[model samples]
Target: MTLWLSSGLIFTFAAIALILYKWWDMQCIGVTPVRTLVFIAILFTSGLDVGLIMFPLTEFGGYGNVSDNPEYGFANPLAIEFGFWAFLIWGFYFLTCFYFAIIEPRVQFFEIPVVKFINNVVIIGTCAFTAYLLLANLPWYLPELSSDDGVVPAFYAIVFLSIALAVYSSSKIKYVRILSVGSSLLFIALIVGMWFRAFVLGQGSPADFFGTASMLGEYFGNLNKF
Candidate 1:
């Protein structure tokens, strides 16, 4: 069990490092200021969700054997806690697509160099993320992902497929013509990141500044609801 946990943790770390490295490269080359902000924002929210999930898991005990005792069981507490985390993490992802793929095209009708650059980054990342599912641990098998908690992934896949179709659509639709392919690629990258951090890491990764804030917000937000 310890070995399994360690392996999962390492997978997450490697995935995150790879992602950050890619983002850093983008930053170094001045890919786009907006793109940088988008990645940073997502990373920050992810950190917080993971931290909140960890606090209870660690405090109760390391993820070991499953038990029925309410005091010892991780399922109930973790489910309740991580559900919100998943909600927020996925909420942002969905909103990103809604704004970028749907709304922006209708409203802006133009892409600046930086915005276009960011769009490319998003596309490439999405492609990589989808590839990871096929080669990595295969998160597609997880039942949880198809359930209520999986709404974000489902929507992500939907948005991604839409982007793919948009790529092949009539060229006169300026936004679709310009961004479809890039959006699809970014969707794949994000999926890969999700697989790495959620399934591989299992929410035990270290905290970052943004992640800390997310954790606090969710923890308190949930508390207030109750």
Candidate 2:
């Protein structure tokens, strides 16, 4: 698995470099070309998932336990978390976006009935898995909404409602644009609110914020090790 991961990382980086060299001046006109801001909003919202919200809270302690997970010893837990979510990992998205935008138009592999069916199946399966993850984690995050045996009916209802809303939003391109932009704005507001509550309203100090921010430097310093 490590060898495969390493190969993929190398290939992604090489491909990114090749794309930059060859198509640096070329415009990536997709099948449906929207404005740059809309394109960015779409990618930003699509790139995020339940894992981005839940992973750090669950895995921070595990990453910090370098005695058992010596592979993480090269950097701090915060660095490890950031590395997992950012940097080279984004290259995979870049390659996928580039392929769909540039190469797929020419090859039309996904236009085939079998390939389209398989792609839709994979996408739906991924959405279901994401919902399952949310349901599984909700019991721990909101125990009041769950019973001792397992997830409660309310939790299931919430998940179903969420899936329904997502499907409805995806029914039209205009809905998708509105949702993507709205969600992006809401996320920004959420971050600002949290920061205000923490530093301005709460007892958090600049030193505390800076000290935590400094931990991310370890990731940059040990990029090769990662």
* lDDT tens per residue, model 1, 1-226: 7678566546655655555565434313222333544544444432342343334433333322345344324233444455445554444454454445445766874377887888799877965664443323223334455554434466457546745664565344334323434544565687688667865678544455345446445444453232
Local error of candidate 1 at residue 117 (angstroms): 1.7
Candidate 2 per-residue lDDT, tens place, 110-211, comes to 999999999999998988888898888888788777898878899999899988999999898888899889887887888899899999999998899899
Candidate 1 local distance difference test against the native: 0.48
Best by TM-score: 2
> How many backbone clashes does every candidate have?
16, 0
